[model samples]
Target: MHNGFMRVTALALGIAGALAMGNAHASGFQIRENSVKNLGRANSGTAVAKHDASVVSNNPAAMVNFDRSAVQVDMTDINLDASFTGGGTTAIGTPLSGGNGGDPGSATLVPAISAVFPLSGAFDKVTVGVSVDAPFGLKTEYDPQWVGRYNAIKSDVKTVDLNLSSAIAVTDRFSIGAGLILQRADVTLTNAIDYGTAICTASVPGNLGASVANCLNPAYPFRPQANDGNVEVSGKDTSLGWRIGLQWKPTDHLTIGASHRSEIDHNLTGKADFTAPSAVAAVLGPRVADQSINAPLTTPSVSTISVEYDFNDAFRLMADYQATDWHSLQSVKIFTGGGGVLGNEPFQWKDTSFYSLGGEWDLSPAWTLRAGIAKDESPTNDTYRTPRLPDKNRKIFSLGATWNVSDAISVDAAYMRINVDDPTINGATSSSGSHLTGTFKAHADLFGVAAQFKF
Candidate 1:
């Protein structure tokens, strides 16, 4: 029974991964970009001090620099593009229809919002603030004719976070801050394919192939593919997490910062829908409860550190490092309301780290220029990797500037380019020895703009 449950869960993740074809993982295909200022700096803030609302993610300690009560609002948009580089159809009883790679479907309209407002300063320069932000999200789609449809079609993940924080300047050169994180996340996984092509194969034992085709055909008693019958699962999870940070200005011209957030365990609540061929449903549906399956959500952890250097009068450098415990995502286990196993699957990910370095140059009294570079490692293993994510290590280049509209306001704009190294997966297989091997390339471009207000 435990093995059966595990298999069912694996199948569920496989389905989920398929729908989230371009980007989905233990972190749920989400980006860490939240504030316009950080985007301009390649998200590097481990060290320098800033008075912007972006302090919510950078270093809450930096918020101490803001004197008056202030509020800042920000919005960001992300665009992603991905394409399959190499992979051929499996002829060894492959359970997929159609040919190889197709058009690279695109996803857009990704929007994020965040706000910060400071309260009374009780301690030396102490300020309490509340912020809401989208810390992570993903959107990936593939052409209907892609041969990997059975493994993935379209996958989307979204997350909203609320943080209550406080920061104080302990000394002229030292500051500290902390935040209580409340998180809400949602995931949707979908896969659509021709039932006949998915389950029928001439090499199968007995007359199963003939039966599969006959039952799934449009003219037959069952028309599962008529509307491109799909399997879908949607769920939401809520979790509690926390972060602590410190900023030290050791010298008049240098600054340093560090921060950490603890992991949160989430109990997700959601539903699933499975549209199977009538003949197959008749045999499997009775054993399961319905045409659907449901379960709890997964939990993951993230940690980051950053630093900056202020040189001369208006020039500074930035660097950031982040680590995500993807290894904790080794498996996804779903639970029914009664504590029964609904589904579970292996994620088989390794702990991963990301590094970024950037610089901010004050081009003029009213204009600030930014540029940065970053490198991120992949967490997926070759054997377990599939078209859904087809992930690889990547590099990012970013540039931006803030125009001082007046003494009290500024507008920031940034552009970023992402490049993924081609990844290869060999010896992919089905339980029956069916094999798959391929190479994949992933990339995307993002343009961002945000306005900041100060009083």
Candidate 2:
């Protein structure tokens, strides 16, 4: 009775899904487009740089730098270009191998809004701010009839964050900030099923060897019917995390800041939606129905420290370091509400680090030019690379400018390009018969614009 009751209670979290794909913006799904100023600087100096209200996304302590109320609105357009080339391609158990998967990459638009205000009286040393942005997301879809259909059709994951933060100046040279973060996450992963392989494994276990091979090729008379249907797992969840930071300014020309953001554990609740041929459905039974699935995912935490130095106000140099605790995301495990195992994706991701250096040069009283470069370590290795997220080491180059319309109004525009080290997808997945071997070349272009209004 106790065991049955425990099973019932776990089901209350609902059934959901899990998805993984590469993010060109930052390590893992970390999106750093909160401000065009920071993006132009390759996301460096976010913890210490002062430009707009969007600084709340970095270190809340930076908010104290703004004496007047300011509102910042930003928009970023991303152009994704990725393609796979087949080389020694083969699916161990299925006869599905063809040309390149036809560029699964997709274009995306990310937006952010934030505001900061000062308080009077005893709260003169305090500044309050709020920010809303989509911090993580990307999507990739391949042709339904592609060679890797059984591996991936559509894989996407997205997260939106709402942060409310406040900063207080303890003294002239020191300040602190903290925030409450509320985030929502959604996941969708889809793939095709080889009908012949399922049936042979079920009915004719004795003669399964020759059946799958023959049925996979249409030219063979023993071939099973083509188009056996597809499977899509979808899930959604909400979670809470926290952020804290401190800023220290030893000299008027030098600024330093450190910040730590907590990880969010999400129990996504959704169901498995399957559509298979009649015979295949009968064999799979409840597995293909609206059965409950529960996928637990822990987004990684990050620690960042940044430094900015002003050289006579006309030229500024900035550097920063970021460490992501990706070790927590060791795997994507899914289960039924009744404690039945559904899927286990061994991500085995490792903690990674990022380093950046940049400088901003004042062209005139009204315009400033910014350029930066950064290098990111990959959390994943070649051993676990999959079609879902063929992540690898990358390098970034950025350039932008800030146009001050007046003292109270300014516009920031920037562009960045990312180059992903050519990576090979050669691994097995949760499915027994799924083995994918190929190479992917992926790159991205980012353009952003932000307007700041001070009151």
Candidate 3:
């Protein structure tokens, strides 16, 4: 009974800690599709561009550039294509049977909204704004009987952030701002469990006598993938963080801005449900029963510096650099409701950086054209990469346009293409001693549109 409990706990915690972690459209599962204008320029100058209400989420200090109350609504569609080609897969030194998982990526739609209000009366020097957006999300599902099913079958995570910010113009050339962030996240993960391997590895005597020979016997009821089980974990949490930013206009045509957002820590509590074969369940008994679990997760902090140069009324140039503190997510530790530590899964992710260059051309009194390019570094490396996060460095290209229907209303549209470097999985081993080896070819396309209204 003791051995059965330990096995169950390890499998439960392993899936809960590792598989439930991260994966998304952006590097390290972070989402950057908060504004269509920013997307048009590959996110360049996001912190310094004081042109729209989206500034409320990128850099609150930019709000000082607005004098009127305005609102913006945006919608973005992300289409991802991720496919795996199997080289070789093995389970407990034996070749595993199953085809390569089909394309696991899916198309998703993301929405964002923001409003900025410039104060009057005694508070005329202050500008306040509010924004709601999804900063992180992920979705992937592989075939149930795929060779890598033991590693991960399906993973879904979503997050929502609400920001309230205020900015004050300290002087004609300088402005400072601060904001409070409230974020909520939820995750659901599922994976296949090799019951044959579990029963063979168990130390408890009786039944089949806990031997590999018995497990591999043709007549045995439990043999490798022949009698597989399943486990699912679902969790949710909410947390708070803060951000600060500043913008400086050294000259009439030059602007520089910097911003930092703190990391939010979440303590997620949920249930782990298990389904085992009848024969396996009869032996494991209550050990395979459902139970409550908890884990701790910390989202990374981000810092950005942007510069914008307005050469003339019709032309503008911008560039920016961003850094993410992904090293903070070294490992995920699972715990029981009574505070007992189950185990931990190590990620050992490194910090990542992003760079972009963009420009805008005023084609006509009512039209503007935008173009940009960017490079994004991946935090995961070959040594620690897994099927759950087959991340690689990527390059991005974007084009956009804005139409000023009138002074009170405008529309913006943008398109982006991302090319991800092909990644190889040398021999990612699962908790059940399954090794998945393969190469992944991946890419993504994004389309966005936004409408702005002034009151």
Candidate 4:
């Protein structure tokens, strides 16, 4: 009973915080864009040399032949369509409720940025550069009155990375390079509805039947029940982390590159709010609850190996393989009032691998064309999968082009389509018997443009 009470208390506090923050948010903080064509192919820019910026994304040493120092800027935009399908209507009871669970709206409008530069003539054989990028992040939002509101309303996981690197040409036939990285990240997690108030209301004399019956099935539950959706939690956190990389060029026609990016750990500190009707509050302890917590953010390390072939001056091909040590994110830890622990849930993620292939074709003196493809794996498991993070393995196809507008300037544009397979999450009852199960599907589209300047 004590454990149950403690869990209930934790749930109550969590819900209160979410409500105060305004429900309907999600978090899966993973950013997937760094370059235009590269993004079209699952972000595989490590072994290709199509432009001066390529030196920064792949190997700094590739700059050994740059006639002059340069700068590159890229902007990427994204749109998405996500939904919950194949489930009957139902209600839940925690804070207070009278609604059904079905469809949660999809998320959209993501942006990513990056910049790079070279050292000097004194180090003609070497190049130094820096770039800012996001490797992991996501955004999910549900309706305010949706059954899943209590589980997640608005979720945003984002990050900022700053990297410093040096690339050197050991010989005309070989180039080696390395890098040091620093990163800062922030996360906002929001949950809606109040289960405590809903549970108490359901326990009243004549309300036990609906609660008992719905608790037995896994589809959905109506209000005035222990698990009848009425709880919400919302908060934010920020912290610091770092990574490293290396590259090798064995010949003018072949460039082989390898790199490693370390994990980013953020300690999120923020406030929460809770709201319930008076009747519900009488049983839940209050009509309003407010407090703060420290949430932890984990960004994993990635190791990659890739090879690019310059078949001739007008054509090139590249392929890469990357392993992300997602296992580093095993669980979520939040600190609450009096510096004590509030919630500690297992993330239970494992390492994931990615594969990519790309090709560039010089169509004429003034135009270049590019195409690529790749596969990306998800890090979340079925048991832990929530509406906020309905992630699954996905396939990507991309197309891009560059127009040489002048002797010192070039413009680039690229497009990508991501196909996300339907993802599923099996239901499990809390010790209190609040059952849950869901089938989720989602996908995204992206457009990117950039300007390359040489002096």
* lDDT (Cα, tens digit) per residue for candidate 1, span 257-334: 887767666655666566655654453343324333454444446677777777877888888888876665666776
Q: Specify the poorest-scoring 10-residue window by lDDT in model 4.
A: 17-26
On residues 213-279, what C-alpha lDDT tens digit does candidate 3 reach at each position? 8666888766677768887877789899999999999999999999999988898888778888898
Identify the runs in model 1 with alpha carbons over 4 angstroms from their true place. Answer: 1-28, 46-49, 85-92, 99-105, 110-112, 115-121, 193-229, 279-299, 336-342, 427-436
Q: In lDDT terms, which candidate is top? A: 3
The worst-scoring run of ten residues by lDDT in candidate 3 lies at 5-14
- How many residue pairs clash (N, CA or C atoms closer than 3 angstroms) in each of the candidate models, in the order given? 17, 4, 0, 43
**Candidate 3 segments whose C-alpha is farther than 4 A from its true place:** 1-24, 87-91, 205-208
- Model 3 scores what on Cα lDDT? 0.80
Q: For model 4, how does the per-residue alpha-carbon lDDT over 1-455 read when each residue is reduced to its tens digit? A: 11221222222121111211111111233455666656544455555454646445445555554556566777777656566643322234333232433333343444434344455558667766676665555444566655455455655555556666676767765666666656654455555444442453255333354454444455533233433223334444444444344456667788776766666555666654555555444444532355676666556667778788889999888888888876766766666656876565555776787788888888998998888988877776777664555567777788888899987888888888777767775652332333345676666667888777787
In model 3, pairs of residues that clash are: none
Give lDDT for model 2: 0.75
Query: How does candidate 1 score on lDDT?
Result: 0.61
Give the Cα error of residue 109 in candidate 2, in Å. Answer: 0.3
TM-score of each: 0.84, 0.91, 0.94, 0.80
Whole-structure CA lDDT of model 4: 0.56
lDDT of each: 0.61, 0.75, 0.80, 0.56
Best-to-worst lDDT order: 3, 2, 1, 4
